[model samples]
Target chain A: MHPPRDGRGPADPPAERRVGLILFWLYVLLYGGFMALVLVRPDLLSVRPFGGVNLAIAYGMGLIASAFLLAVVYMVLRSGR
Target chain B: MLHETSATAVAIFAAFVLGVLWLSFFLGRKGQSASGYYAAHGQIHWFVNGIAFAGDYLSAASFLGICGMIAFTGYDGFLYSIGFLAGWIVALFVIAEPIKALGKFTFADALDARFQSRGIKLAVAISTLVVSIFYLIPQMVGAGSLIKPLLGLPHEVGVILVGVTVTLIVVTAGMVSTTWVQFIKGSLLVFFCGVLTILILGRGLAENTGSLAPQTLTVRPDGTRLVDGKPQERGHDLRPVGTIRALPERYGSRRETGALGPLAYLATLEDSRIVTWAAKKRVDAEGTHTVFTPTERSGADLLKPGGSFKGLTTGNLADRLDFASLMLALFCGTASLPHILIRYYTVKDGEAARRSTVVGIAAIGMFYVLTLYLGLGAMTSGALDPTDTNMAAPLLAKTFSNTLFAIISAIAFTTVLGTVSGLIMAGSGAVAHDLVENVLGIPMTDHEKVRCGKIAAVALGIVAMALGILFRNFNVSFLVGWAFNIAASANLPALVMLLFWPRTTKQGIIAAVTVGMVASLAWILLSADTFEKVYGLSREASVVPFSQPGLVTIPLGFFVLMVVSLLTARPAEHRA
Candidate 1:
């Protein structure tokens, strides 16, 4: 029933699709936790966890770092599979 | 504050614009076919496409706006950077490969692939147009703001200049030119910003012992202006503000902290005191009067959240919910954007799409990390243009050298150009490919399709210019936030369900897109912020509880899609 399409790749393999969704939810939880922390204990973010910068700066930068690392992980996992 | 309009800046900016236009013309002959026009023949290298993705994604809102926000208010601006980069995680894991597997020319192509429904095409096309225009407004506004300080031109002239140049780029070679322009611009932005960050780290934090006087601007009924109770004159203008008031006791009587490492810089700042600006406005029978007041805030307070956002510190439920909603929209919006979705098609395969996303994330993440330093540096540089937050980064560069300022400003202009062209490309595709050929059943050859798309691009350029000039006073990042909310609300639910759920009928997609778009739009138009800012009415008179609608509307989209899908489910399909 579907129309033929040009310049399209094969559908995502089922296993790869499953992995993608799993990773996707994992990220949602991580990001959601970040927002939740900001809402609940904003005072805690002001505390310097590592004796360097405060939790807010540390955690915010961590989020950016984590996204990039997770992306590299996904790419490696997909190719390894 | 006033600018002298440096000749070096004008020369550098003119050269950059000319280079981009020449590149567009040089690549003009290659993309005559619809595929090439829309997706650059699906032949771009993944690495190039990845950098181009960064170029396209980091608009004026990211560079000019976020830097300005952080320079003025602190970590609240970086929140936008974090939310923005976080959205790419969604794009990579959820939408990247699958979208490349489904769509041909536009986002509508991907959504309509299975159903072949004209209604789906029409609905998604309209959403694409709406989202693209919302996104375009900020880029154009940023363009106008950049032109004023850099070229000494009026705001309207700057908007038109960008509009005409971008339309020419799209009309000439479409995606071929667009992709290259983005790649070039993206490379330059990340590189120059990195250099600026290093310079900031080298210069370190310096305490200001100078006077922190406030500047007042009063507009008379006859259109005359006065600065500090004196008639507005070229030489007598508002003085620059924003500087460190004191360093920590560890530094003793030292006014400057020589040079510090990244973490040391931040820790030192956490222990320091800084001065920022607060603006107050009032209108009397004489005319409107504005005052730029300097307010001192602890570096610790500014480095943390809740300065500009105000929600975190207030502990009000509506404020918190508004902040949460904005974050959610930013997280979900990247995958839903039509311009970004089309970039997936510029690469050859699903794997390439995935690889390109990772590359984009790397480049974009690096730039964002550098933004923190750039903003914090500007905050204590004692050279901030308090009247305009959008000029913080450029002005920060000015403190170092005129040539550096010129280069930074020129790069920011191309940032606007790259983003605007990508947006216009998305809008034109929605009009020509989705609405005309797919929805209206207009039969057209490849040449005709390309011609139609070019016309649509020109039309969209004009509209964007008008909106830019109309909303000239609005902050660039604020407008972009609304675009994110709209994109997340209208596009995410349908795209996710279509790929994952077998029972998602065409009706569900159509209804979801329509309801989500309408609900978010209506919510925004009725929100307290819009009521006060756009309508010039009291904020308390607005109906919506909060400004951002994504927290409510994104879920509404999914809920509507589910109920409709179940109701319209075929018996055989339901059992499958």
Candidate 2:
């Protein structure tokens, strides 16, 4: 489908909107990837990335952290522009 | 047993109610105009609006339900927080700026702004009410559970009290008081949860298994409760459980671990052996008896997925699909919530909306991170009530200090107040602005509109109280998942299509919303969870294949809107 003239769709809208979309998908990948692993292969999340930190814990904390990180990043990008 | 009412708790709770009522009355002075009453005159400071956004968004479901779920089920419950927060991405990227630019009072205002179609208003308004009611049920339920332990009141009384209080707030001051209420509750909730987590880290982990006692609670139909075949006397209730029954070999013979860092705390929990309760309720000859049995689980096991979402582990294909569907709904539902959407109009411009959303994301994200600690803390704190999972967080606070318990419980009650007020505000807006005024063409003065809204708030408040009392037994988070599914299905499709698709017609929006809302609602009622839980029937006999309706109904909404919009496409009407 083609992009409508409304601001909802643009390959590169502005710096901040672009950053929001990019970070949105990035955060989604981290979250969705973790969820996909849980659905498709439950055992994979059991692997310990390091001592005391398993893939599941890492992925879950990563999702929460990534959200905050992305939001701050968007603010910085918006202010810088 | 989660009941141990302190005079301190009662006094604090009373003070919170008085303060909130006072604020509402004070703000009521400025809310005489339609703009001031509904949209706060579009003058809320961006920072305060941002925190109010956090307060409004983090309902009882977030603070209580997610924490309780994680405390009970482990890592899987945190997924709700992730899905919930991630949905804000859609808001930030697409909906935030545009929504602020479009709507004046409610979510329907944005949808019908361009079309000027009564069909759009009618359909979206009805969707708003449906989603609001679904959302309100869990908040009201959370309120009911909270007061039972703190105030020693019955569950229905708590629900009624909250409904009456919230209705007063909304009817008196509208969004101004609601915004301030949410802002205060939101800040206090995050602050106290942080303090509680710090206390958990300071206290460290210990093997406290000597107090594990399996208890049975029986509740008669007439509201009499019995513990272990004896009536629960005043001020003495059932024991709050959830302790580390045994330790894993890795932490052998180490009764306590010293203060650990954030990562170390989770790491220590992973290799530990914790005892979680498995409850079975049987309604039989005399009364309904729920037996609480202590089951031990390895930390590694608890730290894994599949505890709450059965589809992740040993379930069949349909079960796994149900898990994915619920997650999909949560991810989409955040942007679609009527209460969350209307907050945008409370701000001034698109930039303020964008900034407020970012602030909200940061604040909400930080609180969710604390939830992992709080849930884990409650799981190990030996303060869990096996019968009521909603009490995990507040009861966990009780483990630290009676003062903390009072503060947390009061703040949690305020959490319910803020959220219910927001939901009632959105519903009243739909009733007065969209349905009565727009669809019926009952032209009224601004004062009459505000009066109509107050009446609607009282009526909806009564409905909320009734449902909250009816669904007192449900997990607030689980009930919230249903609301998310409905909102995502009913509202998201029309919204995304309207924003992106040029050929979308007013009729298509109406058909899509009506079909999406009804189909998803029907699917949920016919789903396995409803069959077993609501209808008291066999899950095997349920008609629907999956428990969650989002995977099917959400896609169906978009497809219906696309097909109808294409068939009914008209040129040069709404070109962008």
Can you write out model 2's per-residue Cα lDDT over A34-80, one digit (the tens) per residue? 77898998899999886678898787777877877777787778778
Tens-digit lDDT track for model 2 on B9-71? Answer: 999999999999999999899888999889999999888998998899899999899989998
- Could you give candidate 1's per-residue lDDT for residues B505-550 as a string of tens digits? 8999999999999999999999999998889899999999999999
In candidate 2, stretches whose alpha carbon ends up further than 4 angstroms from where it belongs are: A1-19, B211-213, B220-224, B234-237, B248-252, B571-576
Q: What is the TM-score of each candidate against the true structure?
A: 0.98, 0.95
Question: Per-prediction RMSD in angstroms?
Answer: 1.8, 2.5
Interface RMSD per candidate: 3.3, 4.0
Cα lDDT for residue B74, candidate 1: 96
Task: Kindly report the docking quality category of candidate 2.
Answer: acceptable
Q: Cα lDDT for residue B97, model 1?
A: 81
